[model samples]
Target: MNIKEASSRLGISARAIRFYEEKGLIQPAKQSSNGYRTYTENDIWRLQTIAALREIGMSLQDITHALAEIDQGNQQGLEEYLELQQAVMYAQWVELKRMMDTTQRMMDLNRQDGSLDVSHLHELAGSARRLREARQNWHDRWNYDQQAAIHDQRVQAGKTKEDKPFSLYHNYDEALEQTVQWISPVSGEAGLDIGTGTGNLAGRMLNQSAVMTGMDQSREMLRTCRRKYPQMHVKLGNFLALPFADHSFDFVVSSFAFHHLGPEQQQLALEEIQRVLKASGTSRICLTDLMFTDSAHRDAYSRYAATTGDAEQQRALRERHFPLLGELCNWLGYLGYETKHIRHNELLHTVLAVPRP
Candidate 1:
């Protein structure tokens, strides 16, 4: 096969194959008459091996050394090299996951406030150093730590007070109540809650005998959560990349947290959700947050916010990538989830998504 055919078969770009060739990773047969390279079976196998290693986050130098070991038939050397590379990739995965969380946080900030100020840059710089500290591994844009201190209190308070000009939860307590009600939990079944700040949503399910593990990026929030329920398993994690294994849970749930991610990030979170959910046809995901019914609702909300002259409302409109119900369902459906929309009000929505039988 020529480079084009090999590239097509490998599903990698032609440029990448040429670059690999330049690195001496693989030597293909060259026609004497024209000096054109033609990939043989051995060459294709080497190329495939190189691509696999690279996919696992190997460097070019590392790959070259690994391939050299194989060429020399040094099985012991190749094993050691692979073991070392595995450790390196594991560390890289942790750091990369942290960086991805931080990047999404900044993207969310830029989306919400319409600009990232000098203060934002300073925060980002400080966050790099803070990553060494607990809870700093993932920096939440909304400062959930501060919110964690009073999250439940605020929700309870909203229940009794006059309605605010704008709130992420149309009815805070009601949203949670409905979201928890919608989630059908079987006794002893494993469940995970992403962005499970203070264990509010998971707490209700736990009462029903669901084996719940709550995960959040905020350390302070998790601390409060542990205080509330010392026995429950809790971890510091974000939605973009769930820390659990594939098909680990019977169900996953979250509330008032999904909007923390941008649209693309939301899709990424859903991908993680689908991975962690069991292949059992009954496995499902339940999430509640401020969202639009559709594009028309989003447009009308913008006009309503503008007319109200509430900067907070206007800012909320701009800052929040409030998901559209139809779009979210479409994303869920693409990932093999059948969805049911439960609208709490004009702005708040609960999506109950389950695997299609």
Candidate 2:
């Protein structure tokens, strides 16, 4: 069978079959008379298997290894490959089930509370938009390599800790003050500090809490946190999926990490935080993230954006460079938390989110 027939039989594009050929995964018999490629039923079977594996989330490298094992007369290897596939499918099924359950619960809550406070409705919608902006701005634009480069450049420049692009250094004193203001400060209960970038707050605030656990997604940050606060507990993990049990924490606080997530994931993290907090638990937000109302910052960041990409990408880049206060208030409201913006001289905004009565 020629390329056309092979593609027709496999229900894939001829270009795709050619791509597989380039990958050395498939080779067709060469016809000398017209220099045409020809395939057989066996080739068709191989293509079908490749397609099936790809559909089931197997990487091309994995499929290539499986094919190599088959060519080596290792038939039993197929069983192992199938077992790996089953494991992947099972994990995906579990994730899908969780998503479905969450969506169903959201729907039920929506139906149960047709009288949603206008403030709450606006808060949720605005928060979703802010979350979308954050993902597009910060986390999506920043790859692992970019993060490393930024870290190295800051080090090479001998930049002061205060000169760091995003730092919680200045927020430590204010954070401690806020903790003291908590209506009923729990001084001896376990707490988890999400996004504990430098552990500055964790170290200072640990004295106020019995057991303080600091978790950050960045290993480099965690390394710094560990060295700075040897007695504190620090782990690397995403805020959206904390590795703790429900009601495991007496208080959960994040120092400037919430804006990195997409809106939905932000809410998911908030919900998870609420779940992990004991009844009447408290959360304090000292968002070091900034948004530029200053024309100089706007101009400087604008030039930075233009050098990178299109206007859309530029604005996204700038958004990551700053945080918005009103948007933060909306996010707190959506999560059913009361918010009060603390007056501060620094660009960072402080808000507190407490469970609704």
Candidate 3:
């Protein structure tokens, strides 16, 4: 096969194949009579292997070393090389997850009250440094320490009646009420609240005599929750890996928190929520975040932020990850959830879904 044929058969770009050949990771089998470089079956296999390694996050240098070992028939050396690369990739994943969380927190702070505070910027920098120093492994995408501190501050502010969290949304209370109605928890029915900041929604469910177990990644937030609702069960855990047995809850819900996850992590978290939910159980997610269907919508938001004269809002609008409502519904459906309704406004969205029968 010529380069074009091999590229098509291997599902890689021709330029990528040429670059790999340049790096000595692959080579053409021979030069045809017409002076065209041709690849044999073995060459295609080698290119496929190189592509596979790259997909698994291997660097070019590491892949070259592994390929060299394979050529030398050093099976054990290749295994050791791959194992080392796996460890390095895992460390990088942890750092990237921490950085993602820090960036999300910064965006959230920027969105608050339509202005950025200098002290908040300093706090964000400190949080980034702490995340780097801690180097801890986490199942979810959020940095718990920073999130917990922010939640604690919000809780304190709520107590003082100064700045209520989620107050910016005109329909915040209505959305919460709608989610509760959709879940329709009966007395003694077990419910799980993922990312239950300060146990607000869980407390509301508790009012209906439902058994509420709230989970959050932040210990400080859980502390505040425990103090607020002495009888409610609050645990420190991540949405990606719910620390619960399968089929544990009759219903699951989250409020204004799911958007903290990236698109991939959001799907994983939904899967985890499904795993914990009992058959026929419902999930209501009240999301007070921005969602843009395309770049044009994003540009319009930018203009709106500038017109409003909120520098912080403009930054938040630029940095936040706003998934499309249609895409979110598709993810839920693909995960075997029967999506019931997706209600939205300029600044908020609510998704109601149930486990497929």
Best model per TM-score: 1
Candidate 1 CA-lDDT value: 0.79
Count of clashing residue pairs in every prediction: 1, 4, 0
- Please provide, for model 2 over 10-29, each residue's C-alpha lDDT reduced to its tens digit, 9 standing for 90 to 100: 89999989988999998888
Model 2 CA deviation exceeding 4 Å by range: 1-98, 102-185, 281-288, 291-323
TM-score per candidate: 0.62, 0.50, 0.53
**TM-score preference between candidates 2 and 3, better one:** 3
How would you encode candidate 3's per-residue C-alpha lDDT over 29-118 as one tens digit per residue?
666577788899989999999999999889999898999899999885686566556545645654566579788888888889866787
The lDDT of model 3 is 0.71
lDDT of each: 0.79, 0.63, 0.71
C-alpha-based local distance difference test score of model 2: 0.63
**Leading candidate by lDDT:** 1
